[model samples]
Target: MSAKRMQLFAFFISVTLIWGCQLEEQEFIPDVSGIEAEVDIRRFDQALFQLDTNDMQPELQKLMEAYPELSTLYFTHILRANDPRTAPDGPAPYVKGFLQHESVRNLYDSVQVHYPNMSDIEAELEQAFRFFQYYFPDEPVPNVSTLISEYAIAAFVYGENDLGISLDYFLGQDYPYQKLNPRDPAFSAYLTRTFNREHLTSKAIQTLINGLVPPARQQRLLDLMVNNGKKLYILDKLLPYAPDSIKLEVTGPQAEWLEDNELEMWAFLIKEDLMYETDNRKIRKLVDYSPHSPGMPEEAPGRTANWVGWQIIRAYMEKHPETTMQELIALEDAQGLLDASRYKPGR
Candidate 1:
């Protein structure tokens, strides 16, 4: 062959190889249309806010009857108010007081304006749950509800089959979370940046994962990382359409930083021998919610180790496509999983 033709042939082969790798990395979107799942997000915030303060007794009774478990949970846990069923005066006084509070009312109004309808969120969750049913057909789908919890809880799974979302906590990034009285340090800019509609479905599915997945047997850094990785992998399966930034709970730049530094981070962990370390404080530095991971560069996002573990699990799954999610979760040996994963970064 002529020299020019040979170079062109080589270039074409290289292009084909790169394209093949990209296709392999693309998310595996399963056909979930055949899976039947329904998600109707009951607007508890509207019902509570629209109560008849002048004559709240009858309406409160109706609310209690309608949302038996959720109303009790709201009063007892979210609001810290006396349970209406057991209280001497019932929840009328407390409900009335809460409804009349200027700050609470303002918060509710903002929630309504931001989320005039939960149809979009409901549809996203329904799709996620359909994936859930596709993976685990025997598990019952939870009944979903939305509420404004005065910033107490973001998302929670209660009583085995109920999932609740606190809408006020997700009032977008532009909301003045810092201006609220008794400001919480947890509401820092880095954290609250994710407090928007884009993350609602991921957060809800994460809540369900927490409820379903068993806790790690050991407290070693590797165990925690692998445990969190299992959850993230399952989350990836459930939310195939969500970006890695949303799934990892990191900003776009942060996600890019992690991806770019994957090999460096892995080397750092191995050289320092930090994975088997079981100290809670050290583990928290690598896995907890924070601006950046300690002992790493400032650009490294918190939960760095968890992201590494997720990659390991991904590699392992790719290596063994037949391994089921249940089997992966039940495989408690973190070290074993890592060895089987053969996860060499930048390969």
Candidate 2:
């Protein structure tokens, strides 16, 4: 009824609205636009399977002749010999069996059918590599080599100057050979979400980043979370064109749930004081990749702690505008980052 009371009411309402808007507002990290570097990803899988050879010896010799440099890696690493002692003696006796196996042929055929021309994926790799070179000029851009493997466990394997993609691993989720029928949670997670073509480039880039910036020391849970967060943040920067789901490696609903409960998740971590706890079980459950994060509600996605840590790093970057990507990568002090972040959620 009073003039001052009405003014106070309007001011409070405006404050509430502004605060709510701030909570909902996501900081837009820009994509690396118009990167010109052309990365010609070498197709090791194609070269390996080009010949329909019942005679393994000649084909093996031809492969060695074709890719002299990569042949060593292919034999030693990819198609590992049953006996390594006699290995560069060329095709071990069992090599014939490996080459002629129906499963092996099927896997090779699937990859060939799925990825006839990797030009688009190559361009995506080139763009990500360009950003990497842009940020860290001293580092070398690795030569990409795509191949198929029996295990398909390590989807993207990296070395100092070479990157390898396991093609069979990316042959869509429902690929009959995926072993999803075993009903294992871990296998299900891999097949349902990660085992897809879209994830290849992102995984490759992340692997490169990981090699450059080794995992932070895991003395405390906070350290692990921050390190994981750093990786995700770098991934976000490198693959800016990638959707949040792909970058975060979460489903659509999972991403949405995390975004909605970001503030609540932060509060839960603080209240529980799990950030600095040294218990491996608790830390793994929170930080490691799983179907869902342990100790949180069923609605929460896996790695909620890492998500919170990413937000903290994002907040810290916001507060300290001078912090470069390289500096962020090199940053080892989890506590310092958390303090600098001044990350008060739902404010």
Candidate 3:
């Protein structure tokens, strides 16, 4: 080839590479710096765990005195968590007992060993907070605190101005306790799937959003499904950086199965006329966290109804692109959404 022809080919390759780079850059994650909040995170776990057994009482006293925020957290969350018999004024003995518990000590050691550096999660929280600020500017960004929960009923509990993360709940999926008691009925599949550092921020955001959306109770199967779908859809927008597995609150295989069998699953539900059914047993099979979805293939994951609902909501949004998030949240008619969605899978 001539020199001129070679130069032209090289120019074409450079232009293609530049375009590819720009496209990759456009894939968006929440911009933390863009969020306008000076929200400070309090590491309650670190402070508590750092206490010396030799001077336990004095160390705790000094720690609380130094960080008043932690004092408030202990009185409000840790004390009550250790024992419901606790009161704000009389928490010293309870705190001492809580620290002395073998399980509590073990959890602390695991956390220290497993999650010595939370800088990445700290950054993730900032990004999530930024998204919260962007969507709801008027809402106060809650002060975040990380503490051990001693296996409390709630993992990520929150109030108007404070969000508490139970560090024990998010110790990796293969945490010794979870593995030892794999068949423990109390430990739901969803809880086990999302128990990791990667899900910490996403779960926090979900807890926050749950407060805004009053749950659907005793509603028809379809309504409950759509309500869940709406929540998940909101999450997709809010936590764009989260892996789909985290957002869906499922493992990768489960999500892939749902996607691959979308049409067949929808058909099964429709043919069986399960949408309008109000049978708790039937609805629970499709909606709740379990080993697998009942009445479907044994390989199908639980919450197939939720996956279908998510698809319907996505279809509705795409068809009606003019709808705002506020409008979507306010929508109560699940049947209307389905009708509007024209959701015919395999099309």
**lDDT to native, each model:** 0.83, 0.73, 0.72
Residues 24-80 of candidate 2 have per-residue lDDT tens digits of: 556564455664667787887787766546667787778778666667776766666
Positional deviation of 336 in candidate 3, in angstroms? 2.2
Please name the candidate that would achieve the greatest TM-score relative to the true structure: 1
Report the alpha-carbon TM-score of model 2 versus the true structure: 0.84
RMSD of 2: 7.7
lDDT of model 2, residue 16? 44
Deviating ranges (above 4 Å) for candidate 1? 1-26, 83-90, 181-183
Candidates in order, TM-scores: namely 0.89, 0.84, 0.79
TM-score-based ranking, best first? 1, 2, 3
Candidate 1 vs 3: which has more lDDT: 1
Model 3 gets an lDDT of 0.72
* lDDT of prediction 2: 0.73
How many residue pairs of model 1 clash at the backbone?
0
lDDT tens digits, residue span 125-216, model 3: 77777777776666788777777766663345455746777777787778755564778765655667577788888888788777666676
Scanning candidate 2 in windows of ten residues, the lowest lDDT window is: 4-13
Q: Give the per-residue lDDT of model 1 (tens digit) for 1-347.
A: 54533443454345344533212387577899987787888988898889899998898888989899999899888776686655556578878988999989999999999999988888898899899988878788889989999889999998765899999889898998877743677788888888999998898899999877799999988889989999999999999988999999998999989888876777677657677778877778687788888889888989999999898899899888899888888999887787688665652
